[model samples]
Target: MNTAEVLVESLEREGVECVFGIPGEETEALLFALRDSEVTFVPTRHEQGAAFMADVHGRLTGTAGVCLSTLGPGATNLLTGVADANLDKAPLVAITGQGGLERLHKESHQALDVVDMFEPVTKWNAQISDPDIVHESVRKAFKVAEYEKPGATHVELPEDVASEECDVRPLDRRERVRRPDPDEPSIDAVRELLADADRPICIAGNGAVRTDASAALRALASDYDLPVAATYMGKGAVSDADDHSLLTLDSGDHEEASDAIQSADLVVTVGYDIAEHDPADWNPSGETTIVHLDSDPAEVYEHYNPDVEVVADIAAAVRELNACCADLDAEFETDWYDDVRDHIVADVTPEINAGDPFTHRGVVTVLRDAMADDDVLVSDVGTHKMVIAQNFRTFEPNTCIVSNGLASMGISVPGGLAADLAVDSNVVAATGDGGFMMNAAEIETATRLDCGYTILLFRDDEYRLIADEQTDHRGEHFGTEFSNPDFQTFAESFGIEAYRPDGWDELRDDLEAAVESDEMAVVEVVLG
Candidate 1:
């Protein structure tokens, strides 16, 4: 079989249903190979959209989402999304077509050191110069990308090597890799720590949202009477509908959430990644004893020194802790956290008023109510992301997708496309003016693919997130404002139905209709 054919076979072995990217001259052989396989190749408007699609796909499926690109500019455009996946801990494999090896050493058209450029952002990356290793390389790519603490991995295939004839067969799919479980001593230490603390609080991170992990955590919280506060990326790690939920744990102008953390005697961080919330913000005094549980070891920092660490499969670790809960009838007083929970509930709870302006928090509240428990809402990076994290209530894990690692601005639109492709439930892409305009061209791609999802576009004609930051620091902001076209016309031009909802009544009605429909739609809300 040809090298490209072997690569496609390897991809098939990984159970890759779709590969996203634009077809280019260098990827001609690879494209033809995909054409002959069962894998559907989605061509997006831009390389960044392809990577974002793969990023969300991986986030939903726990498999490595695959994206392809040609050399140079295409690969560069693909960088932001790849970096997003890497930091967000979503498994993704990005494949790039390189120019012929013979001309790669010397500067040539579209021949840049893509492998080198991708090294900093990827977990692992390599270029395959030998046609014989195509199967091995592809297999390695998937393995590394899907490993624990998963992130992006890269595979570079030169055009000449892709076109070469080869006899090597694609590698047989190996058994699923199992993450290591924590030892008895580690579990014992965690049990002891939990038993001693009277006002212990648990912080859930993105890693804690796996179906099994969430189940275990809920049981642990219920049995031990622990309040779970989710990091922004960790929203829905514990359902907001649950009584033990603290809604969201963040540091900012919100005194209630911060006060809750400050009063916490012991912080049990499960699947926590410091990237989502800095340790210093929560542990400014450096006095609270911390318990770390995750797939990876605790990241070393001045503010984050764990008294006990149980590093293993996060679900398994929590399950072990739950089993230990039987040893002690740990009944920490829950009354202290009640006001914190009440404040959060009242904060996100929307009040419809005729005189009120369209607020970001209100949009999130209405949208959350409109969505089903299993539905997915992808939040693009912006001020609205902060609002959603603080106010949006998600009942299930991965239901609310936020790009916090790289926290790229233009992810929501393309992310919605991936979320739709990954799940049977309804998908929504929440974006503000700046973020919407960045990847708005993907409306055409979604329409072309016949993907059904809603684009919840909020327009304020400015980069209000940055503007808000400037207002905090310098007391004024500049160059953070921008303009926009009528998003209704923009979506309609792409052959999709669009709605500009006037008020709360229209917005709630529009949201229900858009989500229930089987065709792509847009609901544009002006946040003036």
Candidate 2:
């Protein structure tokens, strides 16, 4: 068997169902091998779109989503989405074809040092210089990428090495990697702390939801009368409909949830990562006692010194905490949490007087009503992102994906494609005009794949998020406005059905029709 065959075999053994990328000369051998294997290769319109597809796939599935690209420009194009996956804590394996081993000593065309460029953005990375090491490298890439605090990992295979005749076999993934259990002392300390504290609250982060700690989180909250506030990426860590839920706390200053966190005597952060939401934003005083539970220790931040850390598998840690705090006789007060949650609900409540113009909130409200509990919504980075985060309440974990870590735009379309492919759930790629244009070409890719999903494009004809920021700070804005192509025409040009909803009423019907159609469709809603 050749090295490329062995590499593909390794990916299959790793349970990679599909690989996304653009075809190139350097990846010729690998492409042919993948074509012959059970692992399907999804050719995307652009390398960035391919990476975003893999990113969303990773977020949906606990396994690493794989993306491939050739050297230099191709590799560079994949950087943004790969970095987004890394910061968003999505498990992803990024494979890139590099120049031949013989040309390493000299500067070659389309051969920038791909490994060096990927170092900062990846959890681990390596170039398989030797053909024999391909299996080992591939195995390590998947393992590292899917490990706790899951992020992106890279593997580079040179063209010459890939085509080489190597007698090698893929590694066997016989056992699961289990996280260490939380120390008994730490759990004991957390129990004692929870018992002593009068006003305690839980801040659930992305890790909590992604690690399947939501059930345990709900139990902990339900049992202790603890209020659970999710970070943006951690939406639905606890059901927003639950009385214990405090939807989001990312809007720090002047937000009721922020005030709730400040007023709490003890703040229990479950699987919270400092990257998505800064402790300084919510805990300005730095005096609130923190108890963190996760697979890793809390980050050493000025405002995030944890008094007790239950470092273990998030679900296991939370379950242990629940079991530990099961018999607490302490009486805690949740009147403040009730007030904050009520305010949050009121703030996000739609201001729609029937038949009004479709604003961001209106579109989100209608879409939410149309989707099932487990259906997915991939939110692009824009002003609509703020609207969705504030107003849209996900009933289940990982149902609402927002790239808040790297927070890259242009992810929605491609991400929705992956979401559709990875799960048996209806998907909606919600994007503003600005973000939709960035990867609009991928609509064709989605069409080719027959990905039956809805594209909810909010048209404002500018970089609305940035414009809003400018408007808030200053009276005027510059370089934030732009013109949009006829969105319906653009979407239809890709051979997909497009709907330019006339008003709020039409939008609701259009969204339901698009999703129910089970065909590639775009529903354009004009936003102010």
Candidate 3:
């Protein structure tokens, strides 16, 4: 069998149904292999969009998402998005084509030091130089990408390796690799810690969400009457509508969350990835007994040194903890109820209504009014994401998607694109002017792909948060302000409808119309 054919078989075995990428000369064999298989390859306009789509696919599905790229610039373009997955701890397999080893030392025309370039970002990076090792490499790459503390993994295929013939036998997928499950002693220790504490808090991270432990997480938290504070990636793992729900802590501004974390005598951190949260110095104070649980053993000591480290599948560990903790009658903290409330009150960064009457709250209110209960809203990183994090409330879990960890700028458009593709529910993206320009190319993609959605651009003519932070720090202006093209005109350039809202009422009307419209629409709110 051909190496490409065996590679495609392994991908299908891993349940990779959708691949987002653009074809190139180097990856032609892999592309042909994918075509021969049951998998559907989604050809995107740009490699960046492909990576973003793959990222969201992995995020929504527990499976590792795959994105393919060609040699040189094609592979290089994926670095930003690959870095996003690595930093954000998203499950992604980024496959790229490479020149053969003989061309490596010659400084070949399209050759670059791809392995070194991706080393800093990917959790594991490898190139398949020998046809004999290609099958095993593909299997290893998938496992690394999907395992605990999941991040991007790369597999570079040399042109010769892709075209080579081999008597390849697919590796035994079941026995490839196994993550360490929490031992009996470790489980009992955590249960004992949770059972003894009067006021306990759980900080769930990307690990919890990736492990699909939400049900177990909810059961355990509710049993103990624990108020849970989700890091950015952990948002909506438990419903915010729950009575014991605590607001998501902005990792960037963790003043009150830190205070809450310090106040607790026992902190049960399930799948808590410090990469998703700063946790200020990456360690908890000595006063608190921390029970650290995750699937990746490598993550246990890098940040917080826990009193007890339980390495296991997050869902299994949480489920086991729930079973053990269920027998104990733990006292719920009456005082801790007020602690989360006070933090929510203090964390507000009030924006003055000195600019446009279309306030941030007004925008959310209009969106809430028009959107269905299950309709999903994806937001990019900016002042808008924070505003939505604090203000825009979701009726259910997984309804709100934000770039909490990486906090990348160009994510909104591509995130919106993925949401549209992943679900039939109405999708919308809230982005700032600076972030909107980053992936503005997707406006045409949205129209071409018929991803009927709404785009709201907060046009303040400057990075509003940077401007605000500069005013706080330097007290004098620097290079924060810049001129921008009219986004409404730009949206029209993509053949998408554009709406210019002069005031709050007009914005409300436009949002309502955009929701019901068959085509993609952009509503630009001009902020003074």
Candidate 4:
């Protein structure tokens, strides 16, 4: 069998059912092999879209989603998406075709240092120069993709290697990857710390969510009357409506949550990577005892110094904490709960009102009002994402999707399209003008894929989120201004229906119609 055949077989075995990419000379062998197999190749208009789709697929499936593209520009286009996957710790595999072996270091046509370019952005990277090592490399890539704090893996295939024959050796399929066990002393130490604390709080991040530790988190929080706070990607890990659960922190109300955290005696951080949290607002210090639980040992001591570092699976660690805290009789603090509730009312309630024309708050309200309870929301990076997290509430988990850890600009459209396929729920993408233009070409992919998702474009004259912050705080607004294209016209060029809402009334009306429309629609709201 050819190396391409073996690679395809291995991919299918690893539960990779779909691949998104465009055709190129280097990928001809793999494409032919994929066609012969059960794996579906979703041809997208651009390599960037392919990478974006792979990201969305990975987020939805909890498996390594694969994207393929050819050499040079194809590889370069996939970088932003792959970097997004890496930052968010999404399980993705980017397979790029490199120029023929004869062209290496010769500056051949369409040739560049593909592996070197992708190295910094990926968890693991390798070029399949030897056909015999392809299986081992594929296995390694998948392993790294699914490992603790998952990220992207890049595998480059040369033209000759794809065409060369290789032994089709079957690899062993393990039920699950073995994670580090929590040292008994560490668990006992944490148990003691929690037992004595009067007011304890748990901070769960995307790492905890990815590790599927929600049930244990809920139990532990409820047992100890602990208030729960999730970072952006960690939203929906605990139900937002739960009495003990607090939604993603509102920057507008940072002082409120900050006050609560400061007063708390015990802080249990589960898979909480401080990288995703805002350093400007959050600080867990002083007399607070931090018991950190993480799947990755490396991430434990980076930000907060933990009194007890439990390097176990997030679920297992939470389960242990629940067991340890189950017997403790904790008194209820109505005053604390009341304070948090008041903060929610003061900080969050006002934004929900039908807001000012062209403001971020207004755009989110229009979307929240338009979507059904079962509908799904995908947000792009920048101010819109933070606003969406703080304002919008989902009925179920995985309903609100965003590249939280990575905070990639061009993620919403592809993620929205993926959400359209993964769930029968109505899909909507909320993106800024700068973010919209980044991967705006994917509007066609949404149309061609027949994804009837709504693209809500916030057409502010510039990158107001950064520019406003810079101007107001730094006395500078350099390189943050942007002139935007008519998103409606751009969407129309893709043969997709487009809507331009010049005012609040038009926005509300057009948004409602777009949601119920038969095809994908980009509702462009011109902001003041």
Candidate 5:
């Protein structure tokens, strides 16, 4: 058997169903091996799109999503999406093909230090120089990528190594590794802290979503009458429909939620990561008593000092907290935050008047209402991202995907494809004009794969997000405006259905039609 075949077998053993990437000369051996394997290699128009697809796939599934790329530019192009997955805590295994070993000592075509290039953005990375070590390297990549605080990992297989014959077999898949339970002392400390506090709130972060601790988190908050606020990446940690749900806290527009967090004497941060939302914004004085509950220890920051920490499986930790708190007879006050929740609800509630031009809030409201409660919504980075983060309400964890950590543009199209592949529900990819153009070519990929999803393009013909920031920080906007092509025509040319909604009434109908169809479609909505 060839080394590439052994690698493919190992990937299959890891339960990888699909690998996304654009094939090139260096990747020829790996692609040929995959042809016979059960794992399907999804060929995308660009390596970046492939990486984005893998990123979303990992975000939706706990397993590591795989993406392949050739040497040099192919490897570099995958960097942004790989970094996004890393910062966003999505499990991803990035495989890159390298030049033959003989040429490593000198300059060669499409050859560079790929392992080193991937080092900054990956949890772990290695070059497979020996055919005998292929299985171990592949296994380790998947293992590290799927471990706690999941992120990106890399494996570079040189052309000669991939073609070399090897008498090796894939290792048996290991049983699930059990996570340690939170210490009884830590649990007791948390219980004591909550019992003495009157106004306590929970700040849910990306870790909560990744660990699938939403139900347990919601239970803890609901049982204790504690209001729950999520970061942008943690949008659906608790159902926004819940009475105690503060929606999201990243936009800084939810004044009531912000106020509640600032006034709270005890802050219970469940699976919270400082990267998703800064503690300085809420606890500037570093005085609020914090109970940090996560799989990993807290990161040191001036404003974030944990009074108590429960380092364990996130779901288990939250459940234990709820169990311990259930025994307490002390009454906790939530009237203050309950009012805050009301204000948040009112703030996001859209006003759609007849014949009015479409507003960001109005479009979001229509889309949210149109999608099933469990359907997925992928928000590309731009002004629309902020609007979606603020207005979109996801009923389930991972139902809403936003690139808040890496905050990369052009992820929505490929991300929606991954989401659709992962789930049976309808998926929506929402992007602003500037962001949509980044991976617009992926429409052809969607058509070829028969992946049905809606691409909602919010056209303002400018980099509105940066323009708005420029306006806010400076006296004027510059280098942020640009012209856009006819998106409807552009999409249709790719053999995908396209729509241009003249008004809200037309938009709702078009969106419904797109969602109900089995073919990929794009809807261009001009923002007011």
Candidate 6:
């Protein structure tokens, strides 16, 4: 058997169902092998879109999502999405084809140090120099990518190596890695702290969502009558409909949530990552006693000193904490937080008007109403992301997918495709005009695959997020505006249905139609 075949077999053993990428000459051998393998190869218009699809697939599934690319420019194009997966803590495996071994030592067409190029953005990376090492390399890539604090990993297979004949078999699939339980001492310390605190709250982060600890987290908070706030990516860690939900923290913009955090004497951060929200924003003085609960140890920061760290499986840790707290009759003074919850509910409740152009909140409200509670909503990076993070209510974990860590634009479109492939529910991909144009070509890919999802384009014709920031900081906006083609025409050109809502009622009807339809469609909502 050829090395490429062995690699494909290894992936199949790892339970990889589909791979997203654009094939090139260097990847001929691998492509041919995939053709005969059980794994499906989803060809995308661009490598970036393919990587984004892989990223969302990983985010939705605990397994590593795979993306393939050829040498040089193809490899480089996958960098942004791969970096997104790394920072966003999604399990992703990026496979790149390289030039023949002979030419790799010197200058050659489409040849560069791809392994080195991907080093900065991946958890681990290596070049497959020998055919015998193909199975081991592929196994290791998947293993490392799907491990705790999951992120991106890379494997480069040279043309010659892929074509070489090898007598090798994939390694036996090992048992699932078990997470260690939180230490008894650490759990006791946290229980003691929570029992003594006057006002304690829990800040849920991306880690909590990724670990599927939402139910356990909610139980802990509800049991102790504690309020819970989520970060942008951490949205839906607790159902926004919950009485204790403080909605989301968009860099401390929500005054009520910030006040609650400031008033709290002790903070219990569950699966929190500093990258999503800075500690200094809430605990500027570095004086709030923090109980850090996550799979990994806390990252030291001036404002994030943990009084006790339960570094273990987040779900298990939360369950243990709840059990211990229940025994101690732990109850928090949460009457003061009722005002914060009321303010959050009022802030997110949308208002409707029969206006020429719809406001972001109005559109979001209509869209949210149309979608099922379990449906996925992918938010592309822009001003609309901020609006959705603030206004959109998610009832379940991973129902709202926002690229808060990498914060990349143009992810929602391709990410929607992945979301559809990952789950049984419908998907709604929302993006601003500027961000939509970044990966609009993926509409063709979605159509070709018969993937049914709704794309909501917030037509603002500008980089409104940056423009707003410019206006806020300098009192002027520049270099942020641009024009666009008719979105309906653009979408229809790709053989997808399109809609342009004239008013609020029309938008609500269009969204419902799009969701009920079995074909890919785009709804252009003019945002004021």
TM-scores, in order shown? 0.98, 0.98, 0.88, 0.92, 0.98, 0.98
Global fold similarity of model 2 (TM-score):
0.98
**Residue ranges of candidate 3 with Cα displaced over 4 Å:** 32-37, 169-181, 250-257, 281-286, 297-303, 342-356, 516-518
Give the TM-score (vs. native) of candidate 5.
Answer: 0.98
Q: Candidate 2, which segments miss by more than 4 Å at Cα?
A: 250-254
User: Of the candidates numbered 1 and 4, which has the greater TM-score value?
Assistant: 1
- The local distance difference test score of each candidate is 0.88, 0.88, 0.76, 0.78, 0.89, 0.89
**Candidate 1 or 5, higher lDDT?**
5
Predictions: Cα RMSD each: 1.3, 1.4, 3.3, 2.6, 1.2, 1.3
Q: How many clashes (backbone N, Cα, C below 3 Å) per candidate?
A: 0, 0, 0, 0, 0, 0
Candidate 5 C-alpha error for residue 259, in Å: 1.3
Candidate 2 lDDT (Cα, whole model)? 0.88
lDDT of 2 by residue, 276-305 (tens): 788987888787799988888888988999
Q: Pairs clashing in candidate 6?
A: none
Pairs that clash in candidate 5: none
Identify the runs in model 6 with alpha carbons over 4 angstroms from their true place: 251-253
Task: Give the residue spans of candidate 5 off by over 4 A.
Answer: 250-254
Worst 10 residues of 5 by lDDT: 250-259
Residue 466: error of model 4 in Å? 2.2
Kindly list the per-residue Cα lDDT of model 4 for residues 389-481, writing each as its tens digit.
876754455667788766778788877877777677688888988888877777777777778888888777677788878888889897877
lDDT of 1 by residue, 1-528 (tens): 889999998899889999999888899999999999999999999999999999999999999999999999999999999999999999999999999999987989988999999999999999988989988998888888887888999999899999999888888878657778889998888788878878988899988974249988988888877889899887887888999988887522465666787798888899998998888878987777998998888888989999999988889888887777777767788898998888878877867786678989878889988999999999998888988888888899999999998899999999999999889999999999899888888888888888999989888999998898899999999999777887788888888889998888889999999998998998989985
- 1-528 in candidate 3: lDDT tens per residue? 777777888888777887888899888888999988999887877888788777776676656778889989999988777888777777889999988777888867889989889999898999887888877887888788876667799999888888889777677566424465569998778778877787778887777776678888998878767877777667767776676666576422555656677777777887777666766542444446788878764254434667788888788888887776666756668576575656564444333342456666557756777888777788887777777876565555566777766677888787788778777788888898898888878777667677888888888888878878888888866787889997777888888899997776677789999977767989888764
